[model samples]
Target: MRPVSVRRTVTALVSALALASTAASPAAGAPRTIELVNLGDSFSAAFGTGGLQQVEGVDSCDQGTGRDHVDELGSHPRVEVTLDAACAGYTAQEVEDLVSTKPVREALATADVVTLTMGGNDIGWAEFIGTCSAAAEAESGPAPCDALLAQAPARIAAASSSAAETADAIGTESDARIVVLGYPNLFDDRQDSPLISAGRAAQLNDWTDELNAALAAAVAEEGAVFVDVTDRFRGHGVGSADPWILFAPEAGAHNLHPTERGYLCGYFPGLLSQVARTR
Candidate 1:
């Protein structure tokens, strides 16, 4: 998979650029007045995949519709979607700025389902990367990826705690399904590939496992649902007819953001499952 950490880094950068140009408002008079708010980083912000424009009647944003996840539903739990808000390099703390801060007032207010794929880019993955990178330098070539992979769970746990505060906020409001969408498998978990290095794939997958566990715990504590995307994305692992993986030349394809096919198959399929579970 060309190393998931590296790919996610590229996805983070492009996601930031996309977030800078988009804004989220409210969707009105749709089915059941179900307000769907997507608040998170670039993975949730699909950006120029459709480009920016104004959300009608709200008179606040000009961002396009592509960044919205509820729209990705197609028919699953169908509702009117708001492109909502996405902040690139957005930490757990930054989520408040969009939903509660002075800049965007209605970004996350009174919604039926609020979904996000966040925190990995904000946590200490870079430090893990540095550790892996240094290990590689010392061992020569790709050996450091092993060390980096081992340390992923602890890092994600810490990050999820910080992100959990957002779940807490949603709990306070009682307006939406506080769904925390997790990052998918980013590595092969197998050591036979040249594209990934050493035990690097396993390490990344291990970290993702740890992170998902932490997320599940955090969500349960907050009375929310933590949707596990691991198995689903893994099913689409490289070479599957419905691959959720990012390959080459797809812009941030090297990163963890869903491929267009991944979106159609992975995000939607798994997301629909999550919606069904809650309903």
Candidate 2:
């Protein structure tokens, strides 16, 4: 057997060699994979497009359809989607509640990024759309539509306030970057559908612009990034030959929501661009 000092020095050398080997290995120096958490409403959930599938540890109401912008982002080789808390018909308050849930809170703690798409339901966008469609169809006079339009500014302000509060709530739980996505204009004013006149479409687009502006301000105030998809969605509104928005004559949950292609092409690219700039 070797002498005690020689044995000790040999053991130290062996340990140092092992550590050096590990340090030189590719896995040891590789960047950690990014963890993304999705939170918001139907748009983030990709409702009415991909078939419903239950996500483990997620609430039944928050099941993912596997086709939302979150999924698109998750497809990146370096990113892993740890949680998707978005649900159809969820308002800003509902999303806040989701963030407070134990599983979501745990997920947020480890998240590197969080993406939110909300405020539409908070501002009664669906009802406004219905009113606009009815007016365009001549099923009712423009009074109801006009009234809803008049309410838009105030409602948008209130919704923007809620968005800021939600961002604060999210910030408290995670150090992740928060990305808020604004809704796209649902109509192409140049190509009007029989159910929606060009004038009505233009008015609706203007309302969307107002909403986006308010949301951008709110998000900025909260130190979160706001992604505007309007440019990506241009020329692909409801009346376009290749529309990205869903159009239904009867009132339904899916109407005016982005289709699968819209999420893939519009929301994903817009978000990716913003994320790259920040990085």
lDDT of 2 by residue, 1-279 (tens): 324653454345334434443443466475345678888888888874645655566565644354756765676555688987788878888888888989999999988789988899899877877788845448778888888889888999999999888988999999888999998988889955865778888998998899889989987887888999999899989889888888765525566778777776778766655444332
Worst 10 residues of 2 by lDDT: 13-22
* Model 2 spans > 4 angstroms off: 1-28, 53-66, 134-137, 248-252, 277-279
lDDT of 1 by residue, 79-108 (tens): 445545655456776664455653234545
- Top model number, TM-score: 2
List the global CA lDDT of all models: 0.56, 0.77
Q: What is the TM-score of each candidate against the true structure?
A: 0.69, 0.84
Q: Tell me how far candidate 2 lies from the true structure as C-alpha RMSD in angstroms.
A: 13.6
